[model samples]
Target: MDNTANPAFDVTKRLRATSPKSVAIHEEAARVMAAEIVGTVEIACPVYIESASGSRLTDVDGKEYIDLTMGFGPHVLGHRPASVEKALAEQITRGWHWGIHNPLQHRLGELLLEAAPCGEQVVFCNTGTEATMYAIRAARAFTGKSVVAVFDGSYHGVHDYALLVAERSSDRRNPAPRRRGAGIPSEILETVAMLPYNDEAAFDIIRENRDRLAAVLVEPVQSSNPRTDIGPWLRELAKVCREAGVLLIVDEVITGFRLAYGGGQEYFDVDADLATYGKALGGGLPIGAVAGRTDVMSVFNTGSERARPIFSGGTFSGNPLTMAAGIAALTEMRDTPDLYPRLNGLGDRLAEAINRHARQHKMPVTMMNAGSMFHLRFAEGQIRSSRDITSRYVKAEHVFYQHLQECGVLVPGIHLAFVSAAHSEADIDAVAAAVTASLDTLRNDGMI
Candidate 1:
C-alpha cells in the first residue's frame, strides 16, 4: 500500500490549500465527527461546497465545478430543481412533519404504484438502509425462514446482514461470511448467504439452501460496479427465487428513478416480490420505501395477520416534506416526455467519449455505465462484479478523481457517478477532455 507520501494526496493538499476556510472547517469537524465527512469515503480530497445549482457546485473557496456525482445518484433533476423546491416550499407552509398519516403520503404511494408495476402496496422508511433491513425482515416473517441470500460485491445497506460477506470469499461458489467491521456477532452473520453476482450457478446455491432462505436480495444494477449486461442474469435469479418460494427483494436505492421512472424492474422487465427504494425517489430529500406484492408485503398489515406484523415504522416515515418532494419528482418524471432517453443518451455519450480517449492513449482505464449511473475502473477486462474491480484500480482512480477535480469536475472519490438532466453535451465533452489530460499526466509521471 503506497501509504508513504503520495501524488494523489499531494493534489488534495494543493487543492485544499486554496480553500483555507474549508480546511479550517474540516479540521474542526474532525474534532467532533467520526469521519471528517458524513457517508462513505468517496474521495481523496474534501471539497467543501458553499452552494449547488443546476449541474454545478461552488466550493467555499469560490471555485466552481461540474458536478457528476449529482449528490450520489439522488439528484436526477439536479440540485435545487424548481419543481422540488416549489413542492418543498408549499409543504413547509402546510407542515414539515407529522406522526400521523399525511395526505401527501397517499399521493406519493399512488405515484410509486403507478410507476412500479410490482408495487401492489408500499411502506415508507427513512433511508435505503431502513427499507432494505425491513424488506428482509418482512420476507423472513412471511416465509418463516431465517437465512437471506445476497450477492457478493453488492451493497444493500450498512446493516449487519449486508456486511456479512468477506472481500474475497475463499469458496467462490459458496462464499464465506465475514464481518465488514467489528461489533457484529457471528450469530447475525450466520443468517446471510453470499453468492457471486451474474454467475448462473447462483441458481444451484438458491436451490440447495431453499429451506433456510427467506429472500434473495440484489441490486438489478449494482451501484458499486455498474455493469450494463446483468438484466438477463437478474431475471433468471428472480425466477429461481420465485420457484424456490424465496422472496426476491430488488434493492433499487441507487437505480430507482435514475435508470427510468420505474427503475431496474422496469428496465430489466423482471418482477420482484419486494423492492427497496431510496436516493432519487425523494428528489433531493432523504426518504426510502419498500414496495411489493400485496400478499408478500401484507406481513406488515396489522389486521390481516394473526401474529404481530413486521415492525416497520419511523418517526418521519411518511413526513409531508419528503412525500411532497417525491410526488413532485415522480410527477415530473411521468409528465416529462423523453426524460429517460435523454438522460440515458447523455450517459452513453459521456462513457463513449471517455472510453474513446482512453483507447486512443492506450490507457488501462475503462468506464462502465447503466444509464446515468457509472463507474471508472483503472484495470480493464470484463468487470462483472465489485470483486473484479481490483486494488490496482484504486491508485489510478484516486489520481483520476484528483485530476478531474483540478480540471473543475466533481465525481465521488471511489463510487459510481450520476449524470443529471441538467448536464449538457458540453459537460460531456469537457469530462472527456479531462479524462484524456488526466491519463496523460499519470503516464508522464509513470503512475498509470
Candidate 2:
C-alpha cells in the first residue's frame, strides 16, 4: 500500500455502529467479504432502498430520494421502467434460458448493429467486466501484440490490466503501475502499461510501446468524480492507434447510450476498432456487448479456425430475458427523438446550479458535465489526467451526501451524478434545491 494514498481520511474507522437497515446490511457485507476487499473497510453514506421507480427510490424507512446514482448509470430510462418491465413480462410468458441460440439475441444484436455506426459485428455477454475481458482478448488475437494500455483512474471493472493505477508522484520518472488489490499478480501488471487519462504524453507512451502494444483502451470521458471531457484526446488516440497499427478499443460501459444512442463513438466522432457497452444499453438487465468493424470482429465468427481459441462462453451470454429488456431499452432511446437533447439540458442545468451554490457558500467544489454525465471535484485547478484527481477531489465535505440522502436525493457512490430521460424540470429543481440545502447546512456548521 502506498503511504501517499493512505491519507488520514481515506482510511475509514467507524466512530460507532448503528442498527439502521443500511448499517445492518453493510455489517452483513463486512462479515461475508474478505478483509482485503476495500468495501469491507472504507465506507460511504447510507442507502437501504426498498423499492425504486422512475428517477426515485424509497428506502426501508419510508424516505423518498431523487436517485442520481441510477444504479451506477445503468438505469438511464429510470428504475423499473415500463418498457423493460413489459419486455420482461413478455419474456416470462415465453421462457427464461434454453442453453442455445435464440431469436431474441439475434434481434438485439441486429438492433445494436443498427445503432452502432463503427460496429459491423456484435457479441453478447453478461456484464461489462466480461465484455472488456473478451474485447481485450479479441484485440490481442487480431493485432498479435501482448500489451494493452488503459488510462489511469479509468474504471474498467475487475481485470488484470485495468486494475493498475498511476503512481502517486508528480515527476514523470516515478510513474509505475500500482495494483488495485493485494492478490493481483505482478506478472499480470507487467503485461499492461498505464497512461494518464487525457494526457498529451499518451502519444509518447504509445510510441514507446508500439511494438508490444496490441490495443490502447480508453474511456472517451472519465465520468467519475469531476467529469472531464476528453473529446480532443479521443481524436488523437484514434489517430495514433491507426498510425501505430495498434487497435483502439473504447470502453464505453458507463458512457454508452446515456450520452448518445450510439455511445462514445457518436459523441467523440472518432471510430475505434472495438467498443464495449453495458450500463444504459442493457436497460436494467444484466447485459453487455462488444462491437467492432468486421475485419477485427470476424475473429469471433462461428466456424472460423482462427476464432476457435478466442473463447467467450457465458451461459447467460444471450439469455432471452436480457435480450428482450435490451431491445426495449434501445428502442426507447432511438424512437424518442428529443430525449437526448432534453437530458443534456437538464444535466447542464444541474451542473450550473450546483456550482453556483457551491461557489456562493465558499465551498471549493466544482461540478462538471458532458451531456447527461456529471461529477464534482474539490480541486480548483484544471483536471486533465487521472493523476489530477487527488484526495482533495474525493475527500470533500461528504456530509453534503449524507444531508442530500436525508433530504431525498442520491448522488453516485462518490462525487458523481447522472441524468436520465425520466428526469424532468421538477426533478432537476428538487435536486438543485437539495444541493443548496446541503451546502447551507454545511456552511452553518462551519464545515464548508
CA error at residue 53 for candidate 2, angstroms: 0.9
Clashing residue pairs in all predictions, respectively, total: 1, 0
Estimate the overall C-alpha local distance difference test score of candidate 1: 0.85
lDDT of each: 0.85, 0.77
Clashing pairs in 1: 42-413
lDDT of 1 at 123: 92
Q: Write the per-residue lDDT of candidate 1 for residues 292-393, one digit (tens) a residue.
A: 999988899888844768777889898989999999998998999898999999989989988888888788888899888888778767676677667875
Estimate the TM-score of every prediction: 0.96, 0.90
| Candidate 2 per-residue lDDT over residues 88-141, each given as its tens digit | 998899898988999888888888888776788999999888889889999988
Model 2 Cα shift for residue 405 (angstroms): 1.0
For every candidate structure, what is the RMSD over all alpha carbons to the true structure, in angstroms? 2.1, 4.6
Clashing pairs in 2: none
Question: How far off is residue 104 in model 2, in Å?
Answer: 0.5
